[model samples]
Target: MTPPILTVRDLVVTFGTREGVLTAVNGVSFDLYLGEVLGLVGESGSGKSVTGLAILGLIDPPGQIARGSITLDGAELIGKPEEELRALRGKRLAMIFQDPMTTLNPVLRIDTQMIEAIQAHERVSGKAARERARQALARVGIPSPEERLDAYPHQFSGGMRQRVAIAIALLHRPAVLVADEPTTALDVTIQAQILAEVQSLAAETGTAMLWITHDLSVIAGFADRIAVMYAGRIVETGSVVDVLETPIHPYTAGLIGSVPSRNKRGVPLAQIPGMTPSLAKLPPGCPFSPRCPRATVTCRTTMPAETPFAGARMARCHHPLTGEPLAA
Candidate 1:
């Protein structure tokens, strides 16, 4: 296993909302190695997206990184000034959202946007930047990149717009790319194509990618490792095969069981009971105890320490499915 290219430890993000200081992300931690895609999967409001945003220094206003360490290529990023963070954002760190419009400007031409993206970090001539933009579009499988560069966001279809967004994000070949469900809105056919293309691109460029999504099936064949998050905490982290095949945490097992493809035809889908807890009013013990079937009295009264297993696996639960003893 190569050294992790990006590392996050004990990340805590809080927002001072009307609900009274919500802890959106609580002590989250993970790592991403170059040329590997790590899937951050969980339901909505599970702090998956917030973790990604914090990595790129995008958490603003009432939200703050209350505690944590984010290191990229051996440099700490948690406390870097805004000026330095901005310079690093689209160059060393980049992100794409589920909606292409978030990355694309409807008022600007595609070529204009890409050219500016390149020139912002490099002293390149307009002609040179334009050429790089065209090549990037081509790399992402856009048709007739030369001509399409002159068009605006409105002119391209949904999928095409997303491809263009990906092109810009990868234009600088950033060391890390955070994709928050970039293919969620596209049809299955287009989604599959983009996933393959993005994975290929990441491998070719040696870019560590953190792909955030709520759909387990989306990352089934995409990510090298999977991190299961619930209520702002990671319950399990392991290789896709290991976690999906023999999940230790009940929340992880329930999540795998809820995947549509996991069930036989005509059978009702499995679902985790109870609603996600309010960040401001989380349980005193395990945040997931209210819904976790395997939760015991200890789980509802005392927080469980992360228990380690073979193959670099870890699950934060008291009664893990595995017969291993809890850490002392």
Candidate 2:
């Protein structure tokens, strides 16, 4: 088998505060292959975004990557200098933030911003860079790309701005793209279009994508594989179909069940009881025990290690559900 484009092993990220050290990500591990999309799904504060930030070496002071390895195309990134990481970023690794404004400059015209992005890592003439930027915008379904290039970010609609952000990220055709819920706020139609465009771009460029979102519906048809995270750890992972159809972990099942389509029409939606555990004061064993229905005395006393199952699946649960019904 071909080696994966990115490998993250036993990754841990922590934040130091006056109160205590809070583990934002703990022992998270996964691989992203060329042209593949891995959905990182979790509720808020489950460490999904932190894992992506750590992969890009974007975690600031007070927050640190406590341990583990992040390898992009076999190059270790854990201890690399800021200079080296900056050089690699946007050239070999790019991230699309949840907010388009985070990636765009309100004061700058789209053309100027995109041209600068292209020229930053490559020594290209201004005109050549402009052409590249125009093509990227066109590729992402921006109509009359040339005209749009002259407009500032504020001039475009939310969906259009997001498309521009995606266009900029793809300008370098970075080997990996970490998209942190870029479409969460958009309407379904716009979100679907962006997802299709991104999928096509990834296939064309052989780019591995880590799509971080709390919405399982967003990932159901988009991701090749799914990794369900909870309380700073991945509770279940497998091929999208396998994990969605037979989620062994209670948390994963809860997330899937809570989606509206899974319930009878006009019925109350299924919800996972209890809130996410506080990272600074997590329970001694499984952080999810308090919320997990299947959690037993053993689960509360000793955390279960990731156990392999059929069909390349893994779930961290001592009493994992089997053959559970996922949809109404």
Candidate 3:
């Protein structure tokens, strides 16, 4: 079998604070294959963003990838030299940050920025880089790409700016595209458009994509597979059909139940009972034990080893949910 385009093994990420070390990602592991989209879904503070950054080698000073291996195309990235990682970043892997305005330069015209990105990876001349930039913007469905290229970021609407950011990310045709809440700030219509465009682009380019979002609906619409995260760990993973159809983990079930449409008419929205555990003060066993209805003494006293539910479906729960699954 061909190896996956990207593989993460026992990945652990931690942050250094005045209080102490806080674990953000605890032994998270998954794989992304060529031409597939993987959704990392969870609520806020679930360490979804931290996992994306760790894979991209973008964790800043206070946060670090303390353990585990991030291998892309069979090369370890965790401890590579800065220069080597830098070379890999824009050329082989790219990220679409949550805030597009922050990602694009407010002072520089789109053409200048995009050209610089292309030129940075390849020894292309000024005119050639400009053409490449224009093509990328056009590819992302930006209207009047040439005209938009000369405009500064502030001159564009928020949605347009995000398109530009995504365009930059795709400029190098990176093998892996990590999108961290790429649609969070956009209106539903624009969000839908961007999601469709990204999905199509990934298919055409055979790009392995890690789409990090809190919206399970979005994952249902776009991802081939879904990995449900809770308290810095992946609690369940499977094909979109299996995970959404038969969510074995209680937390996964809760998240699905909380979706507005899942609740009955005239009823309060179904909700998971407790807040996410603090990274600095996580409970003794399963980080999600406090909120999980199925949690038991085994869940509170010792972490449940991952158990298989079905093909490629794994859930970490001693007493998992069982029955008809909720609809997305």
Q: Which candidate is the best by TM-score?
A: 1
Clashes of each: 0, 0, 0
Q: Compose the digit string of candidate 3's lDDT tens values, residues 88-164.
A: 99888999988876878789899999998888889989999999888898988888999988899998888898999
Candidate 1 deviant stretches above 4 angstroms: 323-328
lDDT of 1 by residue, 91-146 (tens): 99999999875668879999999999999999999999999999999999998999
Evaluate model 1: give its TM-score: 0.97
Cα deviation of 249, candidate 2, in Å: 0.4
TM-score of each: 0.97, 0.96, 0.96
lDDT (CA) for every model shown? 0.90, 0.91, 0.88
The positional error of residue 200 in candidate 3, measured at the CA in angstroms, is 0.9
- The sequence of per-residue lDDT tens digits that candidate 2 reaches over residues 1-328 is 9999999999999999987998899999999998899999999999999999998999998999999999998999999999999988999999998876556888989999899889889999999999999999999999999999999998899899999989888889999999999999788899999899899998898889999999999999999999999988999999999889878888889998899883468899889998988887899888899988888899889988888877778888888887432222
User: Which of the two candidates, 1 or 3, achieves a greater TM-score against the reference?
Assistant: 1
Q: Predicted candidate 2: what Cα RMSD to the true structure? A: 3.3
Model 3 worst lDDT window (10 residues):
319-328
Please give the distance, in angstroms, between residue 292's alpha carbon in candidate 1 and its true position after superposition.
Answer: 1.3
